[model samples]
Target: MPTLEDRLRNCTRSAVHLEMRDEYMPSDPRFTAWRNGARNDPADSDPERRPWLRLVADLVAQGVEVRRARIVSEPVSDYIRFEHHLTVPTVRAGEQVRWLPRRRASGLALPGNDFWLFDGTSVVFHHFAGDGELAPDDEEFTDDPVVVKLCSDAFESVWRQAVPHADYTLA
Candidate 1:
């Protein structure tokens, strides 16, 4: 199977990601630094510092629409707040990001895990441990039509209702 970056690089139309967890990678250096009061400049554009920016920018430059929708709880978790703070560069890289309050997602049928759907065809699910750490062999990929459709529909539903990241204020 191709690597996630390889799949993303090959995307011809779109790449969408749905993040349902409020906390992830509790021990991530960036998040740890944020917790210690080290703040990142949202306008910082050093690709080496944030590799995701490079990847997303490359995809967008190729006309592949990249988007991310996060479903978060109200009175957000510290991690979510940190994620919000770090999102500017991502948006600037051409990925449309939105936030949907968990309360507002009550009626939607969503998958059990976070996933990246590429070109409306393949899905990469991210599995994590209870402590918010990514489990070993964390990624699971599938091209099943039913799963692809489920993810596609769920993402669109959240995207339609989620507030653009620019307009969302931390609660």
Candidate 2:
């Protein structure tokens, strides 16, 4: 039997991750219901997904590169993981990963497929292919720079529209 570490290595090295927006629901038949809501907002994180993070951590230990991008409501907390997820591996075995956190200042935009992420290099969507297999509401990217640029422009537009999470925090 392969040890947990070995299994993780295999997964990390050969995993076609399905990027899901924060509103992706794996068990809902309705078109409106997503994976989970505010309390279950894994857009930034969750307990169930921690294993994947651990896997990435392991891969980093073995000189594997991981690129992760998330549309987080509060980018501050998620930024904490960028180092552990990307940098450590680079040092361990010359592995490098990019953890890009696109802060989504909540309440401004609905928690659905309102937006996608295009950080100049990648066009990450929500949910690659699985239980809820479907194209993004905004199907523009089709081997055209215009499509990706549109996504990036949309990101910046949303970014400018969104308010700082700390703006509404209780002191």
Candidate 3:
């Protein structure tokens, strides 16, 4: 039962994340600040200010390909907008990001929950409450071949159709 950080740190080849929720961590301080008009400074490079950036950068440096794709609804939620605005540093850190409008995903088979696939073998599913807060005992990890293949296939399908972050615009 390794932690997410542990799994990430040990990841050797590739790590792909699929985000299907319209909102997450609704009460996160960063989201709150963004709601109030505060914005992330794209120029800010301090790891203390954006530790996730540091982690992704380190992984990329280690030759681990890190990628994330978000399936979002049209006329996106404020949270999505906030995430998009702050994604510059993430892109700069070396993770390839993409966004697929949920409508376009209607024909694709997708996992019920969002997840992270590590090296195409392991999967960590994330559970969230109605309020967009992570549920208690929030994560489920599995190495089952069926589940792993399902997630891996779903992610690749999404990635292939998704628009790169730099090219996506809020609808």
- Please give the RMSD to the true structure for each candidate, in Å: 1.4, 11.5, 1.3
lDDT of 2 by residue, 26-73 (tens): 333322222122223343243244454555556656654443323433
Clashing pairs in 3: none
lDDT of each: 0.93, 0.37, 0.93
Q: Cα miss at 116, model 3 (Å)?
A: 0.3
Local accuracy of candidate 1 as per-residue lDDT tens digits, 1-171 = 788889999999999999999899999987888889988654346677778899999999999999999999999999999999888888998999999999999999999999999999999999999999999989999999999999999999999999999999989
TM-score of each: 0.96, 0.31, 0.96
lDDT of 3 at 21: 95
Off by over 4 Å in 3: 41-45
| Candidate 3's TM-score | 0.96
Q: Which residue pairs in model 2 clash with each other? A: 18-128, 19-126, 19-127, 19-128, 20-126, 20-127, 21-126, 24-35, 25-34, 25-35
Score candidate 1 by lDDT: 0.93
| Residue 86 accuracy (lDDT) in model 3 | 81
